[model samples]
Target: MANLFQKIRKGLQLYQQIDMEALEKLAAKVDLNAVVQNVSKLDDTQLQGVMKLLSGSGGHKKKVPPPVDGDFYDLAELLTPEQRALQLKVRAFLETEVQPIVNEYWLRAEFPYELIPKLAALNICGVTYQGYGCPGLPNIMEGVLAMEMARIDASIATFFGVQSGLAMGSIYMLGSEEQKQQWLPAMQQMTCIGAFGLTEPEVGSGAAGGLTTTAKRTPEGWVLNGQKKWIGNATFADVIIIWARDVDDNNVKGFLVKKDNPGFQAIKMEDKMALRIVQNGLITLTNCQVAETDRLAKANSFKDTAEVLRMTRAGVAWEAVGCARGAYENALAYTTQRKQFGKPIAAFQLIQNHLVEMLSNLTAMQTMVFRLSQLQDEGRLTDEHASLAKVFCTLRTRDIVSRAREVMGGNGILLQYNVARFVADAEAIYSYEGTKEINSLIVGRAITGFSAFV
Candidate 1:
């Protein structure tokens, strides 16, 4: 009996590597002892029969399972048919084109310039605006578009947000008729990309009061002299809307500074751990001269800048929802396939609790943004309303993405899973439009009738 066992073990070892644990499981399903005894003394034909009994394949290859997805909550159904169609269109574009190449570009900290013309074909730029060859979609549609772009790649969404929401919005809301006519069409097509330079080197959350970028009237035009930091798309934009304090009136003014102006220079900000695909620029305006015609006529003070932010802040809240959704979906799918203790980890009660919590937060954010958009369409929205949504959604997104990383265990940090990118991007969203402290104060001031922001 011992000799028979030794012979059988040698034969199995010669054929292929055997995992003892897996072989033990297989051993339970068949009389391996008897089969080994029979095969040890058998000729080639008998051994072949014994092997055939163990092999499950009957002239068919094992089929691979289809990909698992994280959208288990069916949130996409909340979108209207038209909105859903647009969402899918952008999703397809991003999954096919952006997803495949995004990690490589992000690793190098470079923008995918080739996508500009491809994205221009989508005609989604300036989606919420009128004329200028834009689509004139509704405010809800704008939020959907932002969410769609962010679902695949937040850096691309940020680039789009700055161009369509902040830069073009400044012109649409505050520029002279001639200024709008000259810039909007070209910008809509991306023939001339635009950048919004509002945050200075020293002023971020307190930009409205602490901005040191100054503009002085000169015989030639306006001479802009200051430094702007964290200016997205500034490196390559054809025109940049620079917010500067007018020396005469101490009021913030917007100037459309052309890229080629001799005194204006933009250096790419490098070594960023978040949003690596975004090309943030550190801009220096040393007496950068601009034509008076380039001045935004209606943007008289910092109040005008706040108007642009209020419009985009709601979209940022929707973007937070997208980021959370992306992270939750990726983490949920991971737990399903990753096995532990002889079953999917997703089956564990703790994992289900985390997933349910993420979904609840996600649902709340979605519903809030939907109402916020309705208010915007009705022209009944207030700054506090938008601020509240932004604060809640972004705060919840930070929690969702962090939990997503935790649920994936070791693999969560990998870039290919897609959640890691969202995790990093969420940090930017948390503080960008306004910090939580600043946004909370906006809401507090409205509710308590006392300003809390110092």
Candidate 2:
């Protein structure tokens, strides 16, 4: 009788283990007593296997996928702890402060003026320059920061590039000691914004010798007369680094053209499809007189101007990487979450292929820019090196952004999805700094020892 009681208790425990709903369906098909008799005849191993099948413990748990990240090779691991921290800090600031409002500003074709003080507080304006309130970090940091900013919004990246690289760089590389002391600190603090006036209305690719803006030396000062087109940040910049041809020597020189100059007028260029948030201006410098002392002290020729372009072009390559990264990441996330036929589109073979292609290009661009920055830091960077990176990265960025847009179908074109902005912005990046053909000729000239420019 005791043994019978123990068996009853064991049977009750096993009954509790069975799913009542599944048991009810089975009971409707088969006799409950017969099913129990068969289950009771099983050996311990067979009984445990039956229990395993019934419990739905197919031996292991489903594996969770790692988080989506564009840095496939873990490039961030290359930075020092402090450098990595700074990179994250800047990234956090951009994601929090800039990402939320970027689409609105880009749609309105306006700059967010309020971000200036906040961006300044980060103290990252003059990223690579030493002294004068600059961070004096390595060139890689500048490139990384550029990537981080562009990752969120290319317009903001371009704005910072104009202020830090083009304008401040012109002064730092060619300005007099007094000029650096006067402008560097203020610009670094974001109190005085700056603009770079290089590409004129008619002379972009041929700016080397075709600058129509003429500056004549006068007893009172220098008179700058001509027009500059596509001048970023020109609408409200405190100072404009106007590169003009010397009327007498026919050599290009740079000057500190103040915004308040009566002869200087900047009207915002309207209806830009790409990089609309950047306040590009049609600057008319009628008799824009700049003090002789305000002239870039060391800008003797166009070669000096090329120097600044060479340095900033590397940053542009990194910007391309950032743009590609943003698009690719957004697309990847979208594909995984957007369902079709009861499964993620990302699981589809064609979608996976597209993703692999994007990752392949993105990884290549990132590695290329990483080496490019290393060359800059080592002081071995040349125009060809920068142009090659700019060409390859921008071209691949165009491809990446295109593929990114393609994967999302109709939703890709929507600004709210974010891929559309990159698609438009990639066109601007591809053309600016230097066109693909121009950069190719630069590399062509370096490789073949011949001039391809007409």
Task: Indicate the worst ten consecutive residues by lDDT in candidate 1.
Answer: 57-66
Question: What are the per-residue Cα lDDT tens digits for candidate 2 across 225-294?
Answer: 9999999999999999999999999999999999998799999999999999999999999988789899
Residue 220 error, candidate 2, Å: 0.7
- Residue 14, model 2: Cα distance from true site in angstroms: 10
Cα lDDT tens digits, model 1, 1-454, are 4654565578678654656677777788999879656667887666555556557543344444346443445656767798789888988998899989998898889999999999999888999899988899888888888877777778898999999999999999999989999999998998889999998888999988888999999888899999999999999999999999999999999999999987999999998888889999999999888989989999989999999999999999988887887888778778888889977888799998998888788878888888898899889889999999999999999999999998898788888787788888999989889999999999999999998778
> How does each model score on lDDT?
0.87, 0.93
| Prediction 2 TM-score vs. true | 0.90
Task: Compute the lDDT of residue 78 as modeled in candidate 1.
Answer: 69
Clashing residue pairs for model 1: none
Q: List runs of model 2 lying over 4 Å from the truth.
A: 1-63
* Cα TM-score per model: 0.85, 0.90
Worst window of 10 by summed lDDT in candidate 2: 58-67
